[model samples]
Target chain A: MPEIRVVNFSKHFGKVRAVDNVSFDVKDGEFVALLGPSGCGKTTTLLTLAGIYKPTSGEIYFDDQLMNNVPPKYRNISMVFQNYALYPHMTVFENIAFPLKAKKMSKEEIEKKVLEVTKKLMIDKLLDRKPMQISGGQQQRVALARALVKEPAVLLFDEPLSNLDAKLRMMMRAEIKKLQSDLGITSVYVTHDQAEAMTMASRIAVFSMGKLVQYGTPDEIYNEPKNMFVAAFIGNPPMNFMENFKVQSKDGELFATRGDIMVKLPPKAKEVKFEKTEGLVLGFRPEHCKIAKKEVENSIPANVYVLEPLGRDLIVNLKVKGVGGESELIKIFAEPGMNFEIEEKVYIIPDPEKLHLFDPETEETIL
Target chain B: MAELRLNFFQRNSSKISQAVMIIILVLITSPILLGYAWLILRSFSVDMVHGFIPTKLTLKNWRFLWQEMKGYPNIWRTFLNTFWIALWVMILEALITSMGGYALSRYDFPGRTSMLRFILVLHAFPSISLMVAIYYVLKVIGLLDNLWGIILLKASLEIPWGTWVMKGFYDGIPWELEWAGLVDGYGRFEVWRKIVIPLVKPGIAVTAIFAFLSGWSEFVFINTFIFSQNAWTLSKYVKGIIGDFRFADYGLLTAVGLFYVIPTIVFFFFVNKYMIKLTIGGVKG
Candidate 1:
């Protein structure tokens, strides 16, 4: 059995399914991120794993022992809540020493352990202050120190950096990633931030509508998404979608085209026969598409609908018509300092190796 | 201060409302202050010729009031009775509200909303209306004319408002704080003891103070339920000083009245800060 195994787990709140048949395995010493938009069941899944919630149906196992009936504290896991949840009445040292005191440790032992953990987190100076009296960044460190003091088998983080500002979040992200690896603890982090998950997690599990849609390494999830949902959700600016595309052969050349946008089929796709099909959806990432100065082979024509400059890069929103006479917008990233007027016609040459094709009816990737 | 600061009274230099507010404040406070002044003056008067003002100070009234009063026990004996009753009421009130308010604030169950409403409804009918039923119940329980009976009644009546104040305070505490304790290996009871109780100390102080004062000043229930002079509280003792009205000592009565107000005044001064800031959520009358 893996360090943690959740098999066919489901939690239903009356008529609503909060986490539906979610299943995943976390290896020993692995940091897995549960990532999704709000209300997508990521946090619900994390809570279930923490034993804070009892799954309505399914099995949870820790180190091969059944855990569905285990209370949170007995499960030998610690969770750092999103709000930090430091006791307002307790000093910082007491907050970190709480678990030890609960275990009936001697006063000197509790104090020694608290000092050791606080020193490690560099929050030793804040031992006498209350949570509210400390900076947000310092509070984050204290929350982590408190959670780590118990040295539980697994660590759970519920968007612990969500309350921090962008600069502090970034700094704490690096700190948490380093601390987790140094301790070699099996950790499950819940966050809706794609950037955070992509940067810190050893593996990613993407959830939507109470279901785990994809679970794999960051590289695999980003480069080889299993479905349109995973493809569109994993990247910044998201993957562009051209629905109801059809492969057509005009004068002995097979091309996947919708309205004025056209891309010649690769050698492998050239052999497949096609009538105009509604199930076909073409997908590619914004960073994978390049602007062709002149007509490049297998290129598609699109108008630059709008240009948004984001420091190092300019996102060119392309407007193109589909086969059904419906217009669509696709984002394309251009090198910084490149300028294009609105409505400027630009040819987009999507990287053949990076293009994604999906069957809309099944919502599964075809290539 | 730099942003065109207004005096506390007005930002646009309006003075009419401010003037009216001062007038109303004096109008409301003058009676209470003047009556207190008259009581203090009469307590010191050596003779009726002083006519609401004391010309010469005397300790005879204080001495007689503290040492002897007809139809009641000594001041120390009555003080003990009142002290025990108020202490019991305060402890019971604090215990009931902490649990009741925690449940109301943190959980949802069948009839929770109605229960919250129903507790306040218990206060809707006048105590006089319920007195007959309460009297019979006490008769059946063999608690009539018992000091414990009065203590129970006062504390029970206070649970509704005390619970509401407690619930308001609990509303401000994050549920995550409780959850952290649970995850820290503390049981639910331990969590309340270690986490919830300490954080809600101010709310508890307000509840205890109100309960103590209500018990201390209770009149009707004590007057009806307590028939023995030995069982009399400070309120009954004060009433006893006015018994029969023949050769009444206005100075003695005033001295006792001032003494009766001292404990409350001193008690309020201790907890006044917390009482002012309590959320004391709006409970429907």
Candidate 2:
């Protein structure tokens, strides 16, 4: 198996920089997800790695062999597209055997390998059926079967589960994850779904505006986001931002506040340094903070605007009463069946360890 | 809107709508269907019976066409010549248009759009308009009045329109199919052959039949180019039946015309039988 590495890769289409200077290395047998929102250049990076689009500059190395001039056929990589891209004219047997037939293998060997793959994938009964004759989940399995029959050095997937319904998508997601690890093939999967990345990837490379913003493990990306975008993009309801806060220093300690209410800093705040005091934005995860009925220490008083019950927990959208009668909307995750009602006065106690701070101008994380 | 449509359909019985549709369809198609009926009747007539009525019935005209294969009276030689030309034209046109259409559809190069537009503009002017120029070019090349020359010329003239038709079919095929082939370790041309060409079977079928028919029924070029009896084709001899004074063998002419139309109908049926089933899974859902 060849380990795939991309260094300073950039792809430009006329004036648009579809993929800016980006670099990452996927170890053999590791599943890496290129996660981003729409138009975030994750797809471009995957396409470049697949040799579908040649990199405008920089170098791609598969096992330290420079691949700038390698065509996709010679790149020894297999891709499962989002739409499955099954050969509609061919039956499942023929579709799975296409790459083997391209190699000019013996007919007996081709049939044997196709049967083996179909049986392993539990799709042998569909051998005679065309793609349109099968269900969507079956078609996805056939696509995987086609990609696996070749036994390429590396694998690539472009939102392969995006076409399936919610239930099927989850089922396929687990199946693909298990299959990837079982095969131990270096794979780069491109998708925009946070939960898919969080659940399937060994490591995640989060992208934004054609740039690679953060490359880390799932825990590192979620718990130690490098910027506001990663922090906001990684979470489901997204991290709540308390922006335009005045940074105050007194008694040899730093505090961010809206003038009337006070804020608590994490214990390690002294180790994280930022000097710009005029414009600062504080962020904390919704699940990390809690709603208290009684007034609590280092808390902000707020009135609940809406309470959405999400089975196990409720999302309380609170309008915090700030200085000068200004309001900052905050979401707090609370246990369900608490009988929380709208317009109820409550206090938000944020955990200092889970708090994040950012510069208003750069929007990059300060700690 | 649903209630209004229901009320309207209830007020006007469906039988009236069906009857009106049948009447309109019959009125539109009666001319061609009646012509076929008259031709069949005339083919059985023994003499030049006029005024839309058959006087005497005989197979003598057909027997003459079938039996007289010797000397200058032979019709089979001219039929073979036309058939050979049509077959060659169909094969050559299909091959050239398929590759040319695929290249234009999949690749982008300098003047690509202009070239596609140019093909359209060139086809806009009928080949009949350039007959003199074509004849002079062929005469200079010393290929005029030759069967190969006619076949090549027909294929060339049909390429522009045929390319566009094939390109429209190729456009309907997703590019991911080719990409999958590429990932499967097939080269570019191999992908076109193994993936693309098979997927466009319907387009190829229709184009081949059209090219074959166009070459089969060609009259103006063969008439204008050919002079000697050795170069004579089916259409020329069919017209030759009517003499200079317009006094011609109507029964023999109708018999030959019926013979000429049979291949096209048979070929269409043959192509259609497979086209319907083959087109079923050629495109992705």
- Candidate No. with top TM-score: 2
Q: Stretches of candidate 1 above 4 Å error? A: A249-254, A265-276, A322-326, B1-24, B46-57, B244-248, B279-285
Please state the i-RMS of candidate 2: 1.1
* Residue pairs clashing, model 2: none
The candidate scoring highest on DockQ is: 2
Q: In model 2, where do residues sit more than 4 Å from their true spots?
A: A250-253, A320-329, B1-12, B46-50, B67-73, B243-246, B273-285
CA lDDT, candidate 1, residue B204: 88
The TM-score of candidate 2 is 0.93
Q: DockQ for each candidate?
A: 0.50, 0.69
Q: How does each model score on lDDT?
A: 0.85, 0.87
Residue B154, candidate 2: alpha-carbon lDDT: 91
Cα lDDT of model 1 by residue, A1-367, tens digit: 1399999999998899989998999999999999988999988888888777889999999988999988877877888999898888888998999988888999988888899999998999999998889998898888899899988889999999899999989998999999999999999999988989999999999999999999999999998899988998888999999887777778886667765567766566664444434558999899998897577767878888887888888899988766566778989999666779898877888888788778887788776
